[model samples]
Target chain A: MHTLTDAALVGVVLASFLALGTSRLTSCIRATAIQGWLLALLSVAIHEWPPTGHTFFIAAVSLVMKGILIPILLERAIRQASVRREVEPFIGYASSLVLGGILVVTAFGIAGRLPLPHQTSSTLLVPTALSTLMIGLLLLVSRTKALNQVVGYLVAENGIFIFGMSLTREVPLLIEAGILLDVFVGVFVMGIVMYQINQEFDRLDTRNLNLLKD
Target chain B: MLRLLVLAPAAAGALAFLLRANAHRLALLVAVALLHAGLVLGTWTALPPADLDGHLALDALGQLFLTLLSVLFVPVSAYACAYLSHDTGRPNRTFVGCLLFFLSAMTLVTLSQSLGLLWVAVEATTLASAPLIYHHRSPRALEATWKYLVICSVGIALALLGTFFLAMAASDPRSGATPLLLPELVLLARAHALSIPWLRGGFVLLLIGYGTKMGLAPLHTWLPDAHSEAPSPASALLSGALLNCAFLGILRVLHVCVAADQAAFAQDLLVVLGLGSMGVAAAFILKQPDYKRMLAYSSVEHMGILALGVGLGGAGVFGALFHAVNHSLTKALLFLAAGNLLLAYQSKSVSDVTGALRRLPLTGVLFLAGFFAITGTPPFGMFLSEFTILSVAATHGRYLVATLYVGFLAMVFIGMGNIVLRMVQGDAPAPAASGHGPPSSHAPSPAAASRESWFLTAPPCCLAAAALLLGVWMPPGVHAALDRAVAAVAG
Candidate 1:
C-alpha cells in the first residue's frame, strides 16, 4: 500500500511534466485527469483502516469531478474551438522539457533544506508536489493557447491538491472539502469561459486576443 | 456584527440582479453604498472596544481604511445612479449587480483579520469587477475585459501560492501550532518563523502578486486599458476601491513580515519597486494623449508614492496610508470628472477637445483640482502626505533616496500639468461648441449635451472637497487612528 502511494505520487510529478511537454491539447487534458485520479487515491491512502467518510467523499469528488467532469468539459471546449493542437509554443518543447528538469531538481533541493518536523514519510511527495507546481506554472507562462492555460491551471491546482493530500492527516475534513469545492468550481468556470472565448473570438488562441494592449 | 457588515452589499447585489428597471437597480446600488457608509461610521463606536477576530479583526489600520472606502464610495455610487438613470442596451441589472458585489468584496477586504480570508476577498473583487469593466461592450472594452481577467487571475494565483508558503513558514512551531491566523502568526513571528527563509520568499511573491494589482509598473500593464475601457464610475471604483483592496493585502503580508524580523529586507524590495513604478510613470506621463488613460497612469504614479512612503517607515508609513486615502478620493474624483468630459466632448484624447474650463466650468475646475491634488500640490491631502514622507526620508538619512524620489515626482507633475493646462485653457474645440459631432455625425446619445446632468458634475466636486478637507485638517479620531497604526508598525 505504501509503495502504491509512493508510485502514484511519483506519477503526479511525471503527469505534470507530460502536461507541459505535450503539444496536443487532448493529450495534456488526459494527463491532467490521470493526475487528478492519482491525487484522489493518494488522498485516501493517507489514512489507514479504510479511511473516514469525509476522506472517502473527498476521494470520490476528486475522482468524479476533477478527474471526470472537468476534463470532459475542457475536451468539449477544445472541440468547440479551431485550435485542436499546439503547433509551437513561445518556448519550444525541448526547452520546456529542460526547464521542467531544472524545476524538479530545484524543488527537491529546497525541500531538503526545509526543517519541517511532520510527515517525513512523505518526503518524496513534498518535492514531487512542489515540482509539479513549478511545471504547471511553466506551462501557464509558456503556452499561448487558452485551452493550454486552462490545463496548466488544473495541473497547478492538482499539484496543490497532491500537496494537500500529503497532509490529509493534519488538515481538517471541512477545510479539505472546502478546498476541493473551490478548485472544482474554479476549473468549471474557467472551462465554460474557454468555450465562450473560443466561440466569441473564433479561436482558442489567447495570444491572438491581444487587442487590449496599451 | 462582522458577518452583517460583510453580507449587506452581497444581499443587495442579489436583489439588484432580480430587478428589471435600470433606474431601480441603480437606486439599489446607491442605497447599498450609503448603507455601507452608515454601517462603517457606526462601527467606529466599537473601536473603543478594540475589535479583532484572533487573526481577522478591525484594528486601527483596518478601521481607517474602512472609513476611507465607505466615505469615498457614497457619492461615486450616487453619481452612477443618476448617470445610469436612463440607458440603453443590456440591462443596468448586470452592472448594478456587479457594482454591489464589488462593494461587498471591498468591505470584506477592509475588515479582513486573517491573511487567508483577505486573499479570498481580494480575488473575489477581481471576479466581481470583470463584468463592470465590460459594461460598455465595445470591441475595445471586451479586449480590456479580457486583459483585466487574465492578468488579475494569474497575479492573484501567485498570491495564493505566497499565502501557502506563509503557512509553511509557521509549520515549524509547536506551541503556536494548528491553523494560521494573522494575529497568531504575528505572535509566531515574534519567536519562531522569523528566521525561516521560506517566510522571506513568501513576502517577495506577495509583493509581486498584489503589487501587480496595485498598479505598480512592470506589473501595471492592465491599469491603462481597464481604466480607459470601463465606465467612468467603474473606473473610479477600480482605481479607487480595488487598488486599495490589493494594497491592504500587501500591507497585511508586510505586517506579518515586519513581525518576522526581516522587515528591512521587505522594505528594500518595496523601495525598489516603488522607485521603478515612479520611473515608469514619469516616462509615460510625458506624452500622454488619452485623458482617461493619463489619469490611470497618474494613479499608477500616486500608488508608487504610497508604496515608497510605506517602505520608508517612520512618519513615512503614516503619510503613505494618508496619501492612499487622499489618492482614492482624488483619483475617483478625477475619473468621474473625466467621465463627464467624455460625456460632454465625446472623446478621451486631449488633442481632440479643448477649453474644458470655458465649456464646462464645474467639471473642468474639479478635474483641475483633482490634478493638482494628485500631483502633490498644496491645499490637498496628498501634498501634506508627500511632505511628511520627504521629512521622514531625510530624517532616516535616506537623503539620496528622498531627492531621487521627489525629483521623479516633480517631473510627473510637469508632464501631467502641461497636458491639463492645455486641455482646460485653450479655445473650446470648434466642434464642441456647435452641434457638430465627434469625428462622426452619428454619436451615441449618451454623449449628447442632454446627458450632462448633475450626475456628471456633482460626484467629483464632492470628492474633491473631501480630499481638501482631509488635507487641511486631521480630525480627532482619524489622527488617533493614524498614530496608533504608526505606533503598531514602529512597535
Candidate 2:
C-alpha cells in the first residue's frame, strides 16, 4: 500500500512537470487529466483499511469532474475559441523547466519544516502537493493564452485537492462535494467567458486584454 | 430565517427569468429587495433562533453587512428600474435575474459560518455578477466580463486551497478529524496549539484570494475594466455591496488567526497590503481619464483604508467597521451619480463630459458631495472613521502607517478632485445639451434642461444624505453593534 501510494504520488508530480514542459494545449490538458486520475488513485491507496463509502464516492466524483468533465470543458473552449494548439507561454519552455526544478526543491524544503498532523502513508504527499501548486502558479504567470491559464488554474486546484486528501478524515463529504460543484461552475463560467472573448477579439490571447489599463 | 435570507433572492432570480415585461420584472426586483430587508430587520429585532446545523448564522459582523446590503439594494434596485427602461438595445431579463441572484450570493457570503461554505458563496457571487457586468454585450463589456471571470475564479481557487490548508492545521492526530467550521476551528485553535505555520500560510493565501475579490492592488487588475464597462446600476452594486462581502470573508479568517494567537502576522500582512493598495490607487487616480474608472479607483483606496484599520487593532478595527458602512453609502452614491452622468453625457470619458452641474444639477451636486465624503473630508461619515484610524495608529506607535494613511488621503483627494472639479464645472457641449449625442435616443427630451427623474436621482441623493447623517450622529444601537463586531475581530 505504501509503495503504491509513493509511486502514484511521484506520478502526480511528474504529470505536473509534464504540464509545465508541454507547449501544446491539448497535451497540457492531457497531463492535467493524468494528474487528476493519479490523485483519485492516491485517494483510495492512502486509506489504511478498505475505503469507506465516503472515500469511494469522493474518488468517483474526482475521476468524473477533474478527469473527464473539466477536460471536456477545456477542449470545447479551445475548439470554439479557435486558439492555436501552442501554449505560447510568456516565459520560454526551457526556463520553465529550470524554474520548475527550483519549485520542487523549494516545495520539499517548505514541506520539511511544517510538520503534518500525523505520519502519512506516503512521505512524499506534502512535497508533491506543494510542487503541483507552485507549478500551477508558474503556468499562470508564464502562459499568455487564456485557455492555458484556465488549465493552470485547474492544475493548481488539483494540487489543493491532493493536499486536502492528505487529511482525508478531516474534510466532510458535503464540503468536498461543495468544493467540486464550485469548481465545475467556476470553469463553466470561465469557458463561457473565453468563448465570448474569442467572439470579440478573434484571438484567445489574454495579453490583448491590455486595453483597460490605466 | 437564515435559510430564507439565503434562498429568497435565488427564488426571485428564477422568477425574474420567467417574467417578461421590464416593468414587472423590475418591480419583482424591488419587492424582493424590500422583503430581504424586512426579513433582516425581523431577525435582528426579534433575535430568532439560528440554523440548527451551524451551517448558517448571523453574528454581529454579519448582521451589520446584511443590513448594509439590504439597505443599499433598495436604492440600487430602485435606480435599476429607471436605468434599464432607458436601454432598448437588449432585453433585461438576464440582468434583472442576475442582480437578485448576486444579492443572494452576497447574503450567503455574510451569513456563512463555515469556511468551506463561505468559499462556495464567494465563488457564487463571482458567477452571478459576471453576467451583470456583461449586460451591455458590447466587445468592451465582454472583455471586462472575461477578465472578471478568469481573474476572480483563479483568485478564489487559491482561497479554496487556503481553506483546505486551514483545515489541515486544525487536524489533530489524536482526534483523527476536525471540522472546517469557523467557530469550531476557533475553539480548537484555542484549546490545542494548532499548527501556526499552516494557519499563517493559509491566511496569506486567503488574503490573496479574497483580496482579489476585494479589489486590493496588484490583484485588482480586473476591477477598473469591469466597473467602468458595466452599466451604472451594476457598477453601483459591485463597488458598494460586493466588495464588502469579500471583506467579510477575510474578516472571518482573521477571527481564526486571532484565536490561534498569530494575529500579529496576519495584521502585518494586512497593513502592508492595505498601504500598498492605497499607493496604487493614488498613482492611477491621479491621471484617470474615465469618470467611472476614477470611482472604481476610489473603491480600491477605501478598501485599503478598511484593511489598514483592521490591521491597526483596537480603534482601527472600529474605524474600519464604521468606514465600511460609510464607504458603501458614499461610493454607491458616486457610482449611481456617475451612471446618470453616463446616460446624460452618453460618454464615460471625462473629456467628453463637462458642466455636469449645469446640465444635471442633482446628480452633479451629489457626485461632488460624494467625492468629499469618500476622500475623508470632515463632516462626512468617512472623515470620522479615517480620523479614528489615524489617531489609533498614532497612539499605537504605528506612526509610519498613520503618516502614509494621511498622505494617501491627501494625494487621492487632489487627484480625484482635479478630474471631478473639471467635469462638474465646465459647460455642456451643444450636442450633449440638445440630447443629440449617442445613447441619447432613449432620452425623451432634447432640451438643455436637466432630464433627472425622481427614480434616477433620488436613490443616490438619499444615499449621500445617509452618509452625511452617519457622520454627525452614531445611534447608540449602531455604536453597540460596531463594538461587538470589533470584539469579534480584535479578541
Candidate 3:
C-alpha cells in the first residue's frame, strides 16, 4: 500500500511535467485530469481497501470532479471559444521543463526541512505535492491563453487537494466538499469568462487583456 | 437569526434573477437590504448562538464586520437602483443578482468561525463579484472580470493550502486530530505546544494569500482595474464590504497567531506589508489620470492603514477597527459619487472631466467631501482613527514607523487632492470639447435627471453623513463593539 501510494504520487509529478512540456492545450488538460485521477487513486491506496467516511467521499468526489467534470468543462470551453490548440506559452517549453526540474529539487529540499506531525511511509508525497504546486503556478505565469491559466489553477488546486489528504481525518467532510464545490464553481466561472473573452476579443489569448491601467 | 442574516440576501438574489420587472427587482433589493440590516441590528442587544456545530457564529469581530457590511449595503443597494435606471442598454438581471450574491458571500465570511468554512466563504465572494465587475459587458469590463476571477481564484487557492498548513500545525499525532476551528485552535495554542515552524509557515502563506484578496501592496495589481471598471455601486460594495471580508480571514489567522505566541512574526509582516501597500498606493495615486482608479488606489492605501494599525497592537488595534468602519463609509460614498460622475462626464479620465461642481452640484460636493473624509480630515471618522493609529505608534516609540505612516498619509493626501481638486473645481468643459462625442455632449447631464430622485443622491449623502457623525460621536454601542472586537483579535 505504501509503495503504491508513492508510485501514484510520482505519477502525479510526471503528469505535471507532461503538462509543462505540452504545447497542445487539450493534451495539457488531459495531463491535469490524469493527475487528478492519480490523486483520487492515492487516497484509496493509502487507506487500503474499502475506504469509508471522509476518505471514500473525498476520493469519489475528487475522481468525478477533478478527473471527469472539470476536464469536460474545459474541453467544452475550448470548442465553444474555438481557441487554438497550441499554448504559445510566454516561457518556452524547454525552459519551463528546466524550471520545473529546479522546482522539484527545491520542493524536496524544503520538504526535508519541515517536520510532519504524522509520518507517512511515502517519502515522496510531500515533495511531489509541493512540486506540483510550483508547476501549476509556473503554468499560470508562463501561459498566455486564458484556458491554460484555468488548467494551471486546477493543477494548483490538485496540489492543495493532495496536501489536504494528509489531514483527511482533521478536516471535516463538509469543509472538504465545500472546497471541491468552490473549485468546480471556480472553473465553471472561468469557462464562462473564457467564452465572454472569445466573444469580445475574437481570441482567447489573455496577453491582449491589457486594456485597463492607470 | 444567523440564517436570516445570510439567507435573506441569497433568496432575494435568486428572486432578482427571475423577476422581469426592473422596478420590482430594485424594490426587492432595497427590502432585503433593510431586512438583513434589521436582523443584524436586532442581534446587537443579545448575541446569537453559533450554528453548524460552532462553524458559524457572530463573535465580537464578526459583529463589527457584519454591521459594516449591512450598513454599507443599504446605501449601495439604494444607489444601485438609480444607477441601474440610467443604463438601459443592458438587462440588469445578472448585475442585480450578483450584487446580492456578493453581499451574501460577504455575510458568510464575517459569520464563519472555522478556517475551512471561512475559506469557502471567501472563495464564494470572489466567484460572486466577478459577474458584478463584468456588468458593463464591454471588453474592458470583461478584461477586469477575467483578471479578478483568475488572480483571485489563484490567490484563494493558496489560502486553502495555508488552511491545510494551519490544520497541520495544530494537529498532534499523540492527541490524534483536532478540528480546524478558530476557537479550538486558539485553545490548542494555549494548552499544547504547537509545531512552531508549521504555525509560522502557515501564517506567512495565509498572509500572502489573504493579502492578495485584501488588496495589499505588491499583491494589489488587480485591484485598481477591477474597482475602476466595475459599475460604481458594485465598486462601492467591492471596496466597502468585500475587502473587509478578506481582512476578516487574516484577522482570524492573526487570532490563532496571537494565541500561539507567534504574533511578533505575524505583526512584523503585517506592518511591512501595510506600509508597503501605503507606499505603493501613494506612488500610483500621484498624478493618476483616472478619478475612479485614484479612488481604487486610495482603497489600497486605507487597507494598508488597517493592517498597520492592527500590527501596532494597542489602541492601534481599536483604531484599526474604527478605521475599518470609517474607510467603508467614506470610501463607498466616494465610489458612489464617482459613479455619478462617470454618468455625467461619460468618462473616468480626470483630463476629460472638469468642473464637476458646475455640471452635477450634489454629487460633486459629496465627492469632494468624501475625498476629505477619506484623507483623514477632521470632522470625519477617518481623521479620528488615523490619529489614533499614529498616536499609538508614536507612544510605542516606533518613531520611524510613525514617521513613515504620516509621510505616506501626507503624500496620499496631496496625490489624491491634486486629482480630486482638479475634478470638482473648474468650469464644465463643453461636452464635445471634452471629447466624449456629440450625442453625450448634447444629452442632458445624468446628474440633472438623477437629482430629482432622492434614491440616487440620498443614499450617498446619508453614508457620508454617517461617516461624519461617527467621527464627532462614536455611539456607545459601537464603541463597545470596537473594544470587544479589538480584544478578540488582540487576545
Q: What are the per-model DockQ values?
A: 0.36, 0.62, 0.78
Regions of candidate 1 where Cα sits further than 4 Å from its true position = A47-65, A164-196, B47-56, B85-89, B193-195, B432-442, B446-451
Please give the CA lDDT of all the candidate structures: 0.79, 0.87, 0.88
**CA error at residue B53 for candidate 2, angstroms:** 2.0
Q: lDDT: which candidate is best?
A: 3
Model 3 error, position B346 (Å):
0.6
Candidate 3, which segments miss by more than 4 Å at Cα?
B431-435, B438-452
Clashing pairs in 3: none
> Is candidate 1 or 3 superior in lDDT?
3
Order of quality (DockQ): 3, 2, 1
Candidate 2 C-alpha lDDT tens digits along B1-491: 88898899999999999997887898999999999989989977775566837778888888899899998999999999988876543688999999999999999998888898899899999999999998877778887988898789889988988898898788776665346888888888788657888898899999999999999998999999999999999999899999999999999999999888888899998999899999999999998999899999989999998999999887889999999999999999999999888777778888888888988988899999988999988799889999999999999998888889899999999999999999999787776354555544455343323578889999998999899999899888889989988887767
* lDDT of predicted model 3: 0.88
Docking class of 2: medium
